[model samples]
Target: MVEKKYDVTIVGAGPAGCSAAFFLAKNGFKVLLADKTTFPRDKICGDGISSAALNILKEMEVLKKIESIDHHKIGYVKISSPNGRMMTGRYPIVKNFRDYGYVVKRKEFDYVLFEHVKALPNVHVLENFRVENLVYNKDKVTGVAGSHGEEKIDVFSDYIIGADGVHSKIAKKIGLFNDKNKHRAFAVRGYFEDVQDLSDAVEIHYDSQVMPGYCWIFPTGKTSANVGVGVFNRFNETKEAKELFDLFVRNNKYAKKKLKNAKMKGPLKGFPLTLGSFGSKRSSGNVLLIGDAASFIDPLTGEGIYYALLSGKFAAEAIKKGEPNRLAGEYYEKMWAKKFKNREFMPGYLLQTLMGSRIAINAAVFIGSVSKKRATNMAGVISHVLPKYKMIF
Candidate 1:
């Protein structure tokens, strides 16, 4: 496209980027969606796709494409308290979306999303294009500067959408990075086969050692599953998340039983997660941040995909109704708040803050282990069918 100025430029071709590009181009706007890597690349994630995210894909006519790929359906969720008490419940339908969750590697899921957005004739996608700098003119973001192959490529656009993820260059460049350990989580994930009790249901374990974080076994099928553990970085400072994961799998009685004769299929990978919903400026000047770049991962569930899709579509709506050069940043924030942020934001933030301690987690486990209603209510919280405050012990 050369120096041809476009209506919108999106960095990072993940779900959020593709979602933004999807709407912008469908509306007949010239758009560019660029990523640092090519398709089928592995993205470290829980591999749990909630019904909320699936509904968005269905609305976009892309859910069927995702379903055609290798995946597993989740109808049950089992949560193990730190004291070894287990609670299992059914997934709840939220906002008309089915209760079933889907388990597919982010690598596979992202490929379908990227490919769908890449097909729009009006949307140009550049893989292996790493964004290194933001193009600025008089303190307003005009475009981006990056390298493709051995050559530098620069493009100008009226608006920039930062979907580049947690370590986003655009978010950092615009001074939106909030560096607080309490607001972040570090975790490791790996694939495993031959695990016992393999089912479509996803299981989460809360070991006393990994308080405020968790270990999960989300099945991808009847045989293989994504298994791993995460820990709140602040409380888990000296402990390697991988080592903790191993400790759980090797020592936790239930984990040991389930992992008996299990073989890890791949190397354990780690990723940083931004948690909680803080009242921060999501847009500044002509640039807006969505998805992980905006820190929308759920504090309780550690789910980001649903929020990413939510933010991307809401952002597109804001951009669609605004004047180009003078689009109001506050308008974008207000729109995001009304769509999904206002009702859910404060509660998520408060939950994260409260759960950061060891006492709350232990107490919840103690209470949840004895109360069937409490366990079911917690499942509702996970499904986002019930308010987060319901599970607060």
Candidate 2:
């Protein structure tokens, strides 16, 4: 058995885990950042990153690095309603953030972040480390026990930051995961080549069959795109993800026409989304959940990377306040609550439920089709460039 210790142990080296490790290591804290997979592993996603994520990438000095690589810049968005009405608009310009977004494969994006964090002096990077259990001192978490290949590893820390995805073992061990259908979703994605009429604008289709969810076509290159379909778990019980994906590509009018000549480059992959909901307990004892483990995904847009990165920043900030054993979890809870309060007070969960109704989707799309300003506003809200309150007001 290999024994290790650190000031903080972050499970899962995706965006959230990497962000936490980066910030903590920069602040001179020794951190053990572990992940089950190796670098450059493919993560199933729509591959669209908005301004919310860009703002932090800029702070991390990763934006410039990402720009140097091959990526598609998105300046506009197109929304198609269940009624077949479509509207297109530009991403609203926001202060302190870029007006446009980018689409890069998770395999590429996550690898860059992993490389950046590994170079830090106070960070130890562990690959292929699968956490199997949380070591608890009575009630409070003290460490984690997992396996690296055939070797057993036990890592102790003063605080545990669970940045792992939906099925986080730490969360389950701490009994914080809700696992309710209402707060969960599933999505399937595939890389497509020779997609006809690929554009810089990302496409979101709200077909009736996939109500409460949507289909996305995000361009990655001139002839290649990341195409997928996502559905709330509550409504996805009857069909497999692959079936929904097929239906979206062959039935949705615009998607059918655009994907007619496209060929899937690889097998379709699916992942579960732990959609964010208010009033959930995010922290207990010395463990705090961030990113998908904290359920930070947007209910309407299915966006998690931005919240994951943002929550990671908040977690590091809270831990830096001293007495992490006593105050870190409390600080994290309060900080994230205040920062994400908009989801409860604004049109976040409300809009998601309303969107499930065909009448609501059609009405909104019809209004957007007739009014360019309204279309822009809707796009802004969906892309998270503008607040949802602005659209309603």
Candidate 3:
């Protein structure tokens, strides 16, 4: 057995973990980053990066690298109603900055981020390791016990950060995953190559019959795109995601034509999408949770990459400014509330109301058409921007 110590030990080298490691190591912390899987692991996602994520990447000096990669610039979002009515809106990423987001393969993106973290002098990356359990003493998490291949190892750290995905073992072990409200949706995603007639735009189709959730097509290039469907778990009792997705593809004329000769290049993967105000209590003793471990995904849209990065950075900042025990508890509670508390509540309420009635959707579109600014304000609410009541009404 080998024993080592670190100022902070992060489990799961996903976007959140890597972001945290970068900040922590850069700040002179002796950081240890470990992951069960190797680098360049594939993730099932729509591959759409939002402006918030772009800003964070720019701050980290990774935006230029991301732009150098093969990606498509998305300027507008076209949303379709269940009745075949369509509404289009532009989300300009603000002037003098990346005006729009990009769509890229997670394998490439995650690999780049992990590589950057590994380059940091104060960071040590242990690959091919699974954290089996946390070693706690007197109600404080002090270390983790795990195995790398056949060798057992113990890593002692002053603080532990759980950046693992939705099915977080740390959250479960600490009794945070037992909450009922934390369960959001079941999602299936994949990519298609040789797609045709694609533009620098993302399409979101909201058809109750085809998908209770939304079906998205994010263009990655001229002839390829990332296509996926997310179905709320409550809607899955009577529907299968794959069947609905296939039906959606057959029904949508554009989707049918573009994917006519396209082939699925990867295996379809399914994962749980945590929505709204769910997850275990984020801060407890010496352990902190970030990203999907805290259930930060938007209930309506199923977008989480931005929040994941935000939470990861917040966790690191908290650890840097405060002592281990105090920081772990304070960071989890304050950051969780400041960044995500309002975001979690409003979306679920708005989505439940909108999706429950066709009349409301029509009314919303009517209001949007009559007043673009107001509509934009209404849209901002779902986008986590607080809007005046007059704008939405």
**Most TM-score-accurate candidate:** 2
Model 2 error, position 172 (Å): 0.3
lDDT of each: 0.82, 0.86, 0.75
Clashing pairs in 1: none
Give the candidate order by descending lDDT.
Answer: 2, 1, 3
Residue 319's C-alpha lDDT in candidate 2?
89
Spell out the clash pairs found in candidate 3.
none
Give the alpha carbon lDDT tens digit for every residue of 318-380 in model 3. Answer: 887776446556766777786677545464546654654666666656666566665455444
Model 1 has how many clashing residue pairs? 0
How do the residues 281-370 of candidate 1 rate in per-residue lDDT, one tens digit apiece?
788888998999888788767888988887888778778877654664667888777655655767876766556665666677666667
**How high is the lDDT of residue 20 in model 1?**
89
Q: What residue runs in model 2 are displaced by over 4 Å at the alpha carbon?
A: 344-346
Clashing pairs in 2: none
